[model samples]
Target chain A: MHADPKGVLTGVHFLDGDHACCEGTLAAGARFSAGYPITPSTEVVERFAWRIPTVGGIFIQMEDELAASIAIQGAVWGGAKAFTVTSGPGFSLMMEHIGYAAMTETPCVFVNVQRGGPSTGLPTLPAQADMMQARWGSHGDYAIIALCPNSPQECFDLTIQGFNLSEEFRVPVMMMLDECVGHMTEKVVIPEADQIEVTPRRYTKLPPEEFHLFEPREDLVPDMVKAGDGYRFHVTGLTHDERGYPSMNVETQDVQVRRLQDKLKPLANGRALCETENLDDAEVVVVSYGITSRVAQRAIQLARAQGIRAGKFRLISAWPFPEQRISDLAGRVKAFVVPEINLGQMVHEVARAAAGRAAVIPVSHAGGSVHNPDAILKAIVEAAR
Target chain B: MNQVTLEIPYEIPVDAHNPVEPFLRMDRMPHIWCPGCGIGTTVNCFTRALLDSKANLDKVAVVSGIGCTGRVAGYANLDSFHTTHGRALPFATGLKLANPELQVVVYSGDGDLFAIGGNHFIHAARRNMDLKVICVNNLTYAMTGGQTAPTTPDHVISATSPYGVFEPSFNLVALAEAAGASYVARWTTYHVKQLSRSMEEVLSKKGFCFIEVLSPCPTLYQRRNKMGDGLDAMKFYKQVSKIRHGAPTSECALTKSGEIVVGKFVDRDRPDYLELLRGQMTESLGDRYAEPEVSCSC
Candidate 1:
């Protein structure tokens, strides 16, 4: 554990992706973590359970994912930056509450280290199959923020980003990590405490009597006050009014749903939205995210070195589907390639974004192995020709 | 025995202003509950219990699973979570452990707790987690339009059991006591005052405490059983219940023909899971506990 003298992320060290993610959670100011241990994601809870107490925080092994998610929400409401880590099965268990978090507009982070599944498909293996589920698994027309990290460093960095997004938007942010990044060991720098920027939830500055839990601010995010603060507020899963009470009126539901959707839409147009590489003079754009993005990047580089005009757009925030960027790239490129571990989830989104400007082709795999860089490169070359 | 009407102090005001008025959307006031549903009674008892305990209002986290009783959290003026079906206990367990200072309560129905979440229910009790679990048993799944539940009597008819249910019902008090709940008690809606008092006592208890209230589901259980109304259900309780003090917790069971045994069945000391965890953490970390140890080693 030698520290680098240069001080540019000096404490960087090699650790499995899961441990790195755990460290990233702590770096992001997560003081309370509650989760039931599940395969491929258990290491994260184990790491946090051991690490949190040292920071004068709490970590609890809940009875299940339902408990874990609720506990994390409780911690967040208790004025702590809280998170829960789980995988496919656990994510399925957590979907109902995920909608609850959205409806309540609670600021919390859920790290779903993806594995294959509809139900416990591949417990210890990597799979990016939960992309759609992460965005729309919960029952409702609410907006969600989902980030996919391709490497251990990204796992550490994006978790911080996830917490930030959750706090900033006052929404539950999901760090959609997979087994590849979650288990692979890599060099990750743990920034100094002073170097990290941690954003706590916005508390109501108004008097307790005047505070409204669901009233949107100028930014569309509601002010949250912790429980036990003597502020009385209602929270429910049903479509609600400004005061957090359920209102079945269609107009109220429409207004409330739109705000939840719009609050996250602007994020897709901004800095942390998407990352593009070599798209200027490229004839083919290979779009991908998560571990598949790493392969896509390699594929594009290989194609570019071979004199084929190939570009890459790694989706950082996958949910509000980077339609504008993909549309822009489609006009510039002759074709678009989407390579993913799943059969054809993100490809549909890419196809929608590409529309008629570029021919979109899916390079998909749902096996034990990841989508290869060679296959993606071949797809790019074929499209270029 | 002194006929003492225990004063169950309530946190939410019962006055003209309506304590829940600020949180309640008055237009949505006519909730979905049938008239004389025990859910309202249970909700009243819960709010009163929270108030009597003087629990930190801001730190009170109420979580409920899907059921008629699960709506208790929706009506509360607190940090409430209306979670997925049968998973409220786990969520409450998490909430309690996350903020040990916060008062975490699990308000759920019999089906939510004993059927779908049965595994979590027993395990949470066995761990003796610091939580207040209020199980409102209406004998059937009233929310899904009258389905047979785990707590449904052996000869009860419902949507799933158009013919009378053949399975014997769970003895929740005995189940909780055996599972290691530090506090275990049972009371029917007929004993609302006693139920409220029992809830107050359980709320004040330090370890995992469970109170099973025999709430009446007039629209479902009552209607199906050919019981006329909520009053008829109360009459059945009055005629059948035999309060035997010092009765063994394991012996308490609810049967269609058997006497309803209602009372505080178990109360004893057990180290709560959180305190035990803290002790283990303090012992392991020792002086090196204040700051996080960065591990650069893979």
Candidate 2:
């Protein structure tokens, strides 16, 4: 589908990551958004409120994050591509609705401009501490897509992909941006409307009487109908049947929960987004993401100059972990050095994927800032030994 | 008092045929509401009102938050969403704003609306988003088993308030009026005839229209407080109710045994959210801004 011309800026301009993200959302055809402003993430919605009027979209500052989160789902069911933006404290409040969107299979995006936090630790600085929380924050068994953007340009580019993946999978997609990337100024190129590709909402062509709200097609994803489309369908947060009514049997629970997990299983490796460099004969591999990946590049160069064999692995998609690539590298490399802007989050996944075949070293930061290149270079040198 | 269109029949002719069945998911019944529960009656009145108002059923969508009355979304034969606890208003706000053509209705309970969802309730009304809200106030969180509710009158016995509810209850009518609802009414279940007529009037009106239906929870609220049964509550409404049309919202607070004011207190027109948004955008942004197309992505 062609992007809505009104929303597409269609030009190259110097913009912050937050402002670029708003442009990306507009180009993706999200006509509605509800949010409560939180730091670092606030600029995304602020820019949106200013530009959305020209594009004929609604940007509502809801009561709080909980209302913001659930409100977007309602807009989705009403036939609008919608999203919400928040930081850690707001993201924590939105966890239940994230699970609600997962359980009900609502297609939306949650942009978390992460900062240091156990609880509101550092609102002004950068941190990737919410990586694990983004994947497993919501209770119950469900998997969602999360993408990490390292630059203001990727903040615009990846947001388009995030919305696409969210629509394709019928699940909430997380745009994991740090406070640094969200605030940093850079040139962002927005493609023209015709050049920009959008996956339009897949509305069911089935008649109202024949439509079963939760009944999936052969693709294993059910087609959607908007509210007031005369479907008169019922959708609930409780464990529901194919008819979208609450059913408490063990059989129904198994079917419903299994489908939520199964739908994204294939996308784990097939649609996994990452960048790799010089891994063919590396003695040690560095796995990194977010702004840390940019810093890791410098570390890899420093290690190579010091007569150490090092390669770089930059993760663009943070969840549905690229286990296939990581596991394959575990057999070839002597060790894997994982550096993230948090205290050992994704390193656990790396360790699990490596499964004792190679030594896994975690370079943890207590957040509030990104890792120094030397600290990562030190870990790469140590892992190489 | 606002005019009730006398041309429209307030009650359904049950003897001729079941007019309400077509408006309900018949297979989903018998409903989960306990006997003597006022929700069933409210649902019936809602269905009748929808029919009487002559609104297009295809363009109506119902949204509900968690609690017993929240189940109305599931039972309604409409494009309905049973959303999260205390979030029906925002959900409806999202739906209504995104699809301005659709008639959005928020149907839920006191705890869902006034307690956990209170912030949304006030903000939505303050914005004057065009939505129809039907709140079944049973005085307690009946779904959670006789828990103290925001509408639980002082001195009422509840499971959470084992001795007695020492906290004062919310004056819902006052809250709605203060928060800037364009249409606000309060009626007990015993006034089904009047309540149904009120629904008929409110359904077609614009802006934030609210109807607080004082209901009875036979199993939890009544049984715990020794308020007899649902029948006793109905009789109690007849005894203590004062049919005061256009009463001041401040004096309309419900007490344990005080005379309950029941009538339409507010029904005046003002620019809704969408209207104000369009006006501001057209005035400020001018040629740069365009209104959204009606048949969006259809």
DockQ of each candidate relative to the true complex:
0.32, 0.56
TM-score, structure 1 vs. true: 0.90
Q: What's model 2's lDDT at A217?
A: 77
Q: Give me the TM-scores for chain A across all models, comma-separated.
A: 0.95, 0.98
Q: Compared with the true structure, what per-residue lDDT tens digits does model 2 show for residues A1-385? A: 7887878898899999888888888888888889998998999999989888877778989989999998898888888899999998999999999999999999999999999898988989999999999999989999899999999999998999999988888899999999989998999998888998888777888898788988987767888888877888888999999999999899999999999988887777877899999998799999999899989999999999999999988889988899998999999899989999888999999999999999999999988888899999999988887
Local lDDT at B63 for model 2: 97
- What tens-digit string does per-residue lDDT give for candidate 2 at B1-298? 2324467557745565567888888888888899899999999899999989999999999999999999999899889899999999998888888788899999999999999999999999999999999999999999989899999999999899999999988999999999999999999999988999999998879999999999989899989878888899999999999899999999999988789999999999989999998998999988988786422582
Off by over 4 Å in 1: A1-10, B1-32, B43-61, B290-298
Top-TM-score candidate index: 2
Candidate 2 colliding pairs, count: 1
lDDT of candidate 1 at residue B228, scale 0 to 100? 72
Error of 1 at A128 (Å): 1.9
Candidate 1 docking: what grade? acceptable
- Summarize candidate 1's per-residue lDDT along A1-385 as a digit string, tens digits: 2222221233869878788887777777677788888889889879887667666567767777877887677666556677888998899989977887888788888999898876879897889989999889988798888998888888888888888888889889889988988888888877776677766567778997788888888988888876656775556677778977767899998999999998887786654477887778879888889888888888888998999988878899997788888887778789999998889999998898788889998998884568878999889888988
Q: Per-residue error at A276 for model 1, in Å?
A: 2.3
